[model samples]
Target: MTGTTWDILLLGGASGIGKSRAAARLAAGTDGFIVEFDDVVSAVQAITTAEHHPALHHFDHAPDTARLTNDQVLALQIATAQALEPAVLGVVRNRLTVDTPALIEGDYLTPAAAARAVDDGQAAGRRVRAAFLHEDEPEQIAANYATREPDDGDQTERADVSARYSHWLAQQARTYALPVVPCRPWDTLPARIREAVD
Candidate 1:
């Protein structure tokens, strides 16, 4: 609890890192509303001129990035995430005006953006907490994905992207002085996130 506008617990990390699960666990014991980054991005895509927005690629027909280089994939994802930042902040702003706190969980909630939100007073609360979770090992991350979607044919690509993004996120969190939680499959990750938020 550090800010004065609204209480927000921003969970950011790579895919398959259990952010949504962590947020759900956090919400169970707290009066917090859940806002998925995908939902906001999807809603925005539905209303806006998505054709012109690079971030809206998740909607409609997405380009097959299987053949693209790793850097290209990262660039595409980062662009989309950056584009979703405003909408995420909008959701945060709206939720703040209400009485309930919010648990915003997503890969798109970059450390830089979270820090900006706090510094800009958008996350005004006595408990403005933000952290990044990651499974450093690509094989472990791929294993996590397998459990979620057993038919995933792009496991290798997904794992690579997750590893790269997770590394970047961890560094970003450290750079911003935010908590960095290692969410290894065997760990009690939700508890770690709870500790970070508390």
Candidate 2:
């Protein structure tokens, strides 16, 4: 569904994977609006309590990042994504009935979650495209991070997490038959992303 034909586009990937840029580029290239999935997670957290959304609130207090391992961080992300899957689906279902030309951006909708949305959209005869941007090389992601934030110091740890998370997302995308676009060769990234979701 070339952006124009889709009602909602589910754009997902790990942090620092150019998802934000993809959303902006895609939105600019089409008649679509951007809606951060984090906003939905935040709204749900605001109306709920830790007891109800423990995964979503695990990092509410912003615990020490140094204390956690990469696997641990990945697990937290998976848990949070699991907790927010329903909300994501709810938004997709709601959009199916409305005229919202939105591109939902974030890691909240993992490939599994996005598959559900795609299935629902199919059942309702609505177009909902999903694409995930990934970078297999952690070093490349770190370099991109550096380019995005020239003043920021080394981002080795962050890049490691992002790389690992991106691998997981890519694998899941393959399993679900979803699009997994490369975020490399930065110059052609935007065009590739637009083509992938289209």
Candidate 3:
């Protein structure tokens, strides 16, 4: 990711752990575009209704995340990722023809699913790779969340959900043989991710 070119890069992780920051670095390094999966999700939600795609719109109508259990939130995230995984693969595969490369990144891009798609691309003779970011400290994540959204007083709860999700995401990444890089000391995160993925 640091020195070499790629057809596509899939970056996934728990919320507020700097997946976007890492993607920006990779995209800048590679002179590629950054594709935010949140935008993809928004686009999907626009064309589809909850009746057809409930997971994609599960949180749309529900403004209060505090009412939902951590497990429920995680389940919804996973479900939405599963639903979008195939399209993600397709976009990566099709975009291979273009001269410009891209980093498709967001929480919606599950590590295991993205890794599987990368593997599929490789098996079919394509150049694609994936890496996940993780934050081991829930407190740090909470601080990051709070800093990112000062008005959101529920950062502690968000941090709890993100921490649990990060742990589960790391487990899945390991099980699928994908690199899970710890995001901290901000300056060294890019190097660590490059080392792990390279």
Best by TM-score: 3
Query: Per-residue CA lDDT of candidate 1, range 1-198, in tens?
Result: 223233777889998878887777667755567888877766777786756764566423445666777777877777777777777667666666666678788888888778776664433554456888988888887878888889866597778888898898889889999889988644578767766655
lDDT of 1 at 22: 77
Query: Against the true structure, candidate 3 has what lDDT?
Result: 0.79
* Candidate 1 wrongly placed segments (more than 4 Å): 1-6, 55-63, 121-126, 185-187
RMSD of each: 3.4, 2.3, 2.1
Candidate that would win on lDDT: 2
Better of 1 and 2 by TM-score: 2
Error of 3 at 104 (Å): 1.4
Please state the error at residue 183 of candidate 3 in Å.
0.5
RMSD over all Cα atoms, model 3: 2.1
Candidate 2 TM-score over all chains jointly: 0.88
Clash pairs (backbone) in predicted model 3: none
lDDT string, candidate 2, 79-101, tens digits:
77877888999988988887657
Question: Estimated TM-score per prediction?
Answer: 0.85, 0.88, 0.89
Pick out the ten consecutive residues of candidate 3 with the lowest summed lDDT. 1-10
